[model samples]
Target: MLDKTGDAEALGFDALADLLNINRVDREKARREGWRTLADLVAVHDLENSSERRGDEWGAGSPLYQACHVALIEFIRTAPAGALPDPFAPGEIFGPKLPPTLTVV
Candidate 1:
């Protein structure tokens, strides 16, 4: 739930990663342990956001945040009623992919 006040832009990638609790270690652990549902992941995100809240740290207007929110909403909306998708599964959301690299030949 990032604020729309352009605050997220002020946050560096590390800061955003910390705020989201999706750092490498944590993400790996979570993936290994498995998240039961997208809702659960959203709850964790909201919980982290709340625990880390520092009085106007961010608001609900940040386009970045909105994009994330929308992504979650879309996931939830498209998910089957009783079948939650494995976001970490092959070709699934959040699946592992190498970062784009530029080669200077």
Candidate 2:
């Protein structure tokens, strides 16, 4: 069965109450935050942190660094021989172009 945060929270509270030998609320509070699972919460949290981490270089202990290292390893393992692009090759030209609606004064 798929695990939900609400289910875990309910189980945890129930266990805690049982261990403490005390009465607790019978109903669980409605979660309006939309995250239903631990994975969902983690994904949202990672996305929130990603923006903050973008400007900084990945440190050795950073999750981003670990993820990038794993990705690079997987890419190297699966990539076909000689499929990599040449870094010295001339790339497409990119520059600001005048808009068609503008006329020279």
TM-score quality measure for candidate 1: 0.26
lDDT of 1 by residue, 1-105 (tens): 334564444764445546665547554554566632323334444323333334455445333445666777888889887688677765667987656789999
Please provide TM-scores, in order, for all candidate models, with all chains considered together: 0.26, 0.25
lDDT of 2 by residue, 1-105 (tens): 135446645666445334323222211221334433423322222221222334444433235344545666788778897786644544513444444675789
Off by over 4 Å in 1: 1-59, 85-105
Clashes of 2: 0
* Model 2, residue 83: C-alpha shift (Å): 1.4
Candidate 1: 10-residue stretch with minimal lDDT:
45-54
Count of backbone clashes, every candidate in sequence: 4, 0
